[model samples]
Target: MFKSGLAALIIVLLANAEAQFGVGPPFGVGPQFGVGPPFGSRPPAGFGLPSLHGDGFPGPHPRPHPFPNPRPLPPPRPLRPPRPLPPQPPQFSSLRLCTTTQLEQDKCLYALDIAGNNSIDLKLECVQTDSFDDCLQAVQTKEADLVVADEHEYLKARSADLVPLLYAHETLTSYYIAVAPKNITLLELSNATLDVNAMDERAFHAAALFNLHRGHDLCDQAAEGDVTIQIIDSADYDPTDDELLICADGSVLYAGDYDYSECNIDAGLELGIFAPRPYDTNRSFTRLLQNVFDTLINSLGQESEVWNFFSDFQGTSDVIFKNDTSGFSLIPVNRNGVTEQKFTSLHCDQVSLDH
Candidate 1:
């Protein structure tokens, strides 16, 4: 009777404990009735509410590392308008031309006057030198902006740093002519005496013609059966004194500008103009002068006042600014031609033998 009473009392105590803690193995085995993650235990992998750990599925949850939010970028500064550039300085207006000879000086002045009239912006000045050499020197030293020279002068000035800009066509024409005995054969003229008007003007062309005909050197001492070349003024030459006479067409033309058609002989070389190097860069100045020349040329056939200022004497005026030349043309300094080369060769150091 005493053992049965003790067992009943123990059973009643166990039942009351079950009612207090609910059904489960003691305090931490299996899931509790309605509680999550029973006590300190974890759910099975991938088999519970998401806990921000273990593949984001319900399972063991790890403490998440703290991360600060990134600071936003500063707003871009506003763009400013660009500053304006300064204006350029003004261009040169005055032009100085260096020339030789009274005719050329007068022509240059007259051309400048016409150009100045056409354009108020230009101011042309003239500096007259006694000779082509002086003109070239003035240009080289920058004492003068330009100098009008011939092919020979141009060639010489090239070594001195002179520049050839534009050709003053219909301005000046130099004709070299050879007047040999009409009936004498080249071989028979071996003993002939040749007279030249001016050594500087006619020597090369005359010698070239002589060489082309007789295949002899005009500069070397006359050999047996060779022609003797002599320099003399054309005005004093007599037909009986020399077998050959080399002269310029302008020399034959009368002072009043009349052509001596009877004196036409074998035609010769012609030389044009060579300007200073700076003229190549002075586009405005050259263009103005060129326009003035063009106007004068066009007015040649018409009854225009432009013709009155141009004193062309039988079209042989030595004035370059007037419309007297065949036409204007430009040749680069690098241009090479047989005729130009031949003419240039005659001026070589060997030319001293002619003296």
Candidate 2:
């Protein structure tokens, strides 16, 4: 009875232990605890703890670690250099021109306006004075750079140590024609009375030519002339059959049957822009003036619609330029082909009589 009771007690204790654990092989019988495989035998599925290899399956699901390995970063890019600055414009000199009259001052201002509108690189300033002589003095003292003057004034400018830099080619026909009877000749009029209506530059030029022909300086003074000369201001004088008219030649004049070309004088005269004698040696300023002249000539047609350079203002016959001026010429009076032939006969000091 005692042995039976003890056996039943032992069986009850074994059942309780099995329930707490699992019905698998003994702990160290088939595969050692936590070992990879059996010694020389293939291991069963899920025989050990969960692994990092191949899906980590047949065991408990894998729990990710608290921290993971980070990926490598790429290399940084190099920095670029800064940009450069832009260039600047050059400096230029200013040109000053002298004006005697109010009309001339206005014309110079108008020219400045035109140059500004066209973007021309001209820095022109107008210096106004009381008289034309004052203008010449201003140019001499460096108060002004240039002045516009006529042929008569050009001679005066030369006496003041100024030189002609540019000249206007007069559009009008400039000839001093001597008209007389058809039978009259130039040499036969040496002692005969010749009529000049005005004591002007034309008369002086005619007297110069007559004195050259008469082989004597008989008509140096404009009003004082030889017996061959006569002023037509007298009312007693009438148009005689042999009366000679020394007048300006033009298409309107009717010199019928008279060979006027036989005793004609080419008044190679025009307005000139005079500057100080030192300007003739300034190459840069000369180039600048030439460039300005070229720009003016090229823009004439366009500028005429806005402002005419050759047009008169305020009842004036000629303003800045002569009304009859066609264009500007760089060639000097003595070197110019158009005037060289006629200037040879004038007996001027500057002119070469040869060729």
Candidate 3:
């Protein structure tokens, strides 16, 4: 039957007309085939429809989608006006003070903190990533502001014309040598085996082989042609426990490893893998200045006293301060340009590869 017909029948039955309203009939039996529920009579059972429950009455009534949520809502209480959220710390327009390692990144941050925002609203971070060939890639990709590495590596980079923003002496202790026989020296040997390990395997090998070759050469130079030395293998040899330390009994000369420096007195071997030989000559420092010196020079023009906290460039009495007279030109100006300003820690290091 039509849907409208079914609805009409239901309405008529609900009206409770004993004499029949409009459809001429005795018991008011208007046919509403396939309509809604039966009003006067019970509906037929067992239509064989799927039921949710085993008892078969449309299974469990689908729990209300929201379960009706009939519970009374708690009354609202007077809210203490939210303490005005602490004023957001003034955000510096991000500046990229690139360096290597999150630790080095801390240098930029700490230095800025010392600079104290003096209108230099550039945030800085250090990056630990791929090689300079990759442009310290993380920074090249703008993951960091500036980047840093060994002055030697930096030299290689600079030679490529990619100069850093700053340069200053940094105390380091990274160069080290690992060997089983603790006191073996290249001068004391005809030939010996070696091993190398580092984050950059190729760079490590280059450094390793360079030092080894220089090791043999430098010994003869320092010894005035008295020492004769050669590596155990002409082909690169990996260090091993069984590796031999062929030496000339007592002619221990510096091969530039752990505990051995220009003096080459004798610091003992860094047995086993490179782990124990943490010769940090160029690694750890109170402060290391490295980067494009021009960048720091550029910061001098900003009106902010913040640059006062960075390392001083060129000379002690002079600094790179921003020129406000021309409206913020970052150039290295003498301290005479700044007024009512005090300089804080300004560590500097000189880069050298004259050797």
Candidate 4:
């Protein structure tokens, strides 16, 4: 045991000595870890096979070969001096100017850089479609040099860098309802029946006005009983009070289909259309319709030609938008409306700031 102990001590000391000189396993001496090359000198000879020669020259250092003819850059594109961008394109033919309605037709037609009438190039061939956004895309991509559109459209054109020339329809020609069905009655207020069938929100408002104007006064004297005239909303209307084509007593149902011809009205039927009277004290219905109609048509520039387009659309020829000629000029030049449903019915010409 004593001899074994001596051998173990000597073995440990020798391992520590070897570790100090880095001649043993790396971790045999922790403190010796940082003891390395003092200067930029490499490892002493025989540490490992020399990757480099003892001579100043590098061992197997890569050498350069003779310049094997450098490839030329093809003569610098022949110095063409820009060529003036091809005159900014002389009228981009086959390009389309997409816009809608009477108002935005001009914005899609030209670059703002060249919007002046003097500089405007009408030579540019343009096919007009119905979306202002589409028109702007064409111009932005240099596809269409110009886009002619409504005033509102030009205001919204994406490229502010473009120029716009204002072309306006001096007069606004809108439409109104003269005798739509809804304007015939208070809708649900009274027991009176109307001869017509359909109408709009404005017509509904007129119906309220008609009833209010007719009753609340001397006209009320006609119905001294429990019958009273009150304006009711369309949603509140009761079906029983809404008898279509009610023939009253002494009504001229047989007055014939055409009132111009002969027809005798039954005197006791309790339902009939009143005759057109000159005084028309109860002509509140017609008056209400007239006011709405005037506002709508006059708003649309109630001139005869414009008026005819609205109410005279027999649609005898073209298959475009339907001709709703109820006595108004219905020119299609349709643009987008606030809601898609309100396109024709609610679309209108708005005020614009022209430059």
Candidate 5:
């Protein structure tokens, strides 16, 4: 038994010496236990052989080649010029000039601009319309600076504050004249059909003429003749040929004075330019226009044809805006207690022959 124990002890001591002399597993070895690849052998599936330097010991870790070929650095980008700023709008003094007729609008603006002589920069906004009501509305809404309209339109829109700046002086006075066979008296012509040049004007005049004799105002229903008043184009009709004709004193029929005589209907409204209420009065548009006219006259010289155009208007035709007529004078404000609607009966009942 002693001899067996001694042999077993010697075997144990040999194993311990071998382990201590570096002929055993590494200290605290983990789960990865394997022998390195043989020299010159391909590496394992994932791991690469360590890179070796001239020193012969395993040098450093093998770097991964992520791409087959690395691209060269891009050349430096070119410098760009800065962009330009946007343009600005031209500045000028602006004023709105309103007119009902195209001829008046264009000529007025041109004349005013010419009068300014480029010393006074004027940016004009023009509003041209066919209806007189629209022109008044434009001025009322402050869209227009000024307007030149007929007497009826002016009266319709006029208030205590509104006043006329200019009066288009008509040479011939307006008077309602009735022409019929010498046999018919004015009262007997009640149911008689009448032809007239201006339906609105003459109609009112007719009513007024009748009221003078009857001593009371006539409503539209009662004012109308017993027979339907046929609105005929008096331009084509001869006063002597028509059985009955009612027209203004200056109307075409008046040219044939031999055929017709005035019916003594003196009620008539003169045509004029009424400046829009307080704005026109307060802004002194009247003064401005007067100044413009004076300036034009002075700049063109008093003897220029332009002067004649303004001053030398004969009683031949209606005012021609193209001629730059400036002979307008202020008309006296005589409402004559007449309302604008008083003549609605004349125009409302008849088909608008003008349109």
Candidate 6:
């Protein structure tokens, strides 16, 4: 029994010595017991460890993936084109002018044609009336939009609610000078014979000044005194050196040598283009008139006989505007008033009369 035990102990020591001496399973055979490889040996295929040479037996090492399975980004949304903007409305479609006579209406139509040819964007139409009062009524009732007339005429109708938009002259003052041998005062001419050209438009304007100086109404001179006022044609009337010549400021008799600052009667009035209060409030309408006036004035020297802005039409005198008008100037806003006092209060020098 002791000899058999001794042999069994020898067999167990031999197995332990083989493991400690770097000896293991035979070639091409896996370890029967769970044991690790030697220090210098490579791990078998299909193991978790990476291979040192070439591709590993299982497969190439997968690139480190931040996400194991990622979804592809959706196709970039197509850029939406910007939306289109809407159209804007016009400031004004058209402008209408008021006229008193058929000849005046014809002149307005000619002015419209001239505006169209000159590229002025204003659409002007004319409304004819029986008389100047009827024209004012048409404007007040909105049947007409504007009127070109003497400022005094407009002042007579304060209830018409009209406003001056532009002036046809810088200074509308027409000087009435009395020429009487340079010796007699204007008051002394009460009993003297006063000669005036009947055909002249200024002859009537001088009547007021004559009445002012003489301190009596010349129209009813027989009731006041024997102030013989003779109205004769300009060509036939020849004044003697002793007679009185109450003529306009720029009359040919003065030879441009007259100083009207003294011995003169100034009628401070103007020819203006006027409109209703509502039309005056529209800045666009004001701009349109300024453009139209500037265009017409610029075309004055040009040779076009079809239209004349400042001349007589169809044998009529001062059809739409005064024939003596040189140019136009814009009046200050809100300056139009019911009384002549308001107009006389304006400082003509300070006002911006520019187009």
TM-score per candidate, chains pooled: 0.51, 0.54, 0.25, 0.20, 0.42, 0.52
RMSD of each: 10.8, 15.2, 23.5, 25.0, 16.9, 13.0
Clash counts for the predictions, in order: 4, 0, 46, 52, 0, 0
lDDT string for model 1 (284-341, tens) is 7566555534554554323445434445634555454444444455652221122555
After best superposition, candidate 2 residue 186: deviation in angstroms? 6.4
| Candidate with better lDDT, 1 vs 3 | 1
Residues 1-355 of candidate 4: C-alpha lDDT, one tens digit per residue:
9999999998897786554443533333233455644322444545532456547543565665567676766765566666555333132123233444433344223322232334422222334545656556655655554444432343345233444321222222231111222233444324443221225433332232333333432123233323232323323333332222211111222112322112111110000111122212334433442343343334332243323222222324211111332231212222211121222122222213221
The reply for model 1, stretches above 4 Å from the true place, is 1-47, 53-95, 101-107, 110-124, 127-134, 137-144, 169-186, 198-200, 221-271, 276-289, 296-326, 331-338, 349-355
**lDDT leaderboard ranking:** 2, 6, 1, 5, 3, 4
Tens-digit lDDT track of model 3 for 1-355: 6999999997776565532322223344434654534544333334233334556454445565665667888999988887777544222234344443344445545556654545443344334443444444544454543444332354344444343333332122232322335344544332443333335433333223334333443222233333332322212334445333232222233232323222121111111000011111222210122222323435532333445333333333211211112221122222212111111101012233221
Local error of candidate 3 at residue 328 (angstroms): 26
The prediction achieving the highest TM-score against the true structure is: 2
Span of ten consecutive residues with least summed lDDT in model 3: 268-277
State how far residue 61 of model 3 sits from its true place (Å): 99
User: Residue by residue across 286-352, what tens digits does model 6's lDDT show?
Assistant: 8877776776666641234545577676777667777766777875322111135533222122222
Candidate 5: clashing pairs of residues: none
Name the weakest run of 10 consecutive residues (lDDT summed) in model 6.
Answer: 346-355
- Expressed as tens digits, the lDDT of each residue in 237-302 for candidate 2 is 344555555533312123343333333543446678888887776777777666665655555422
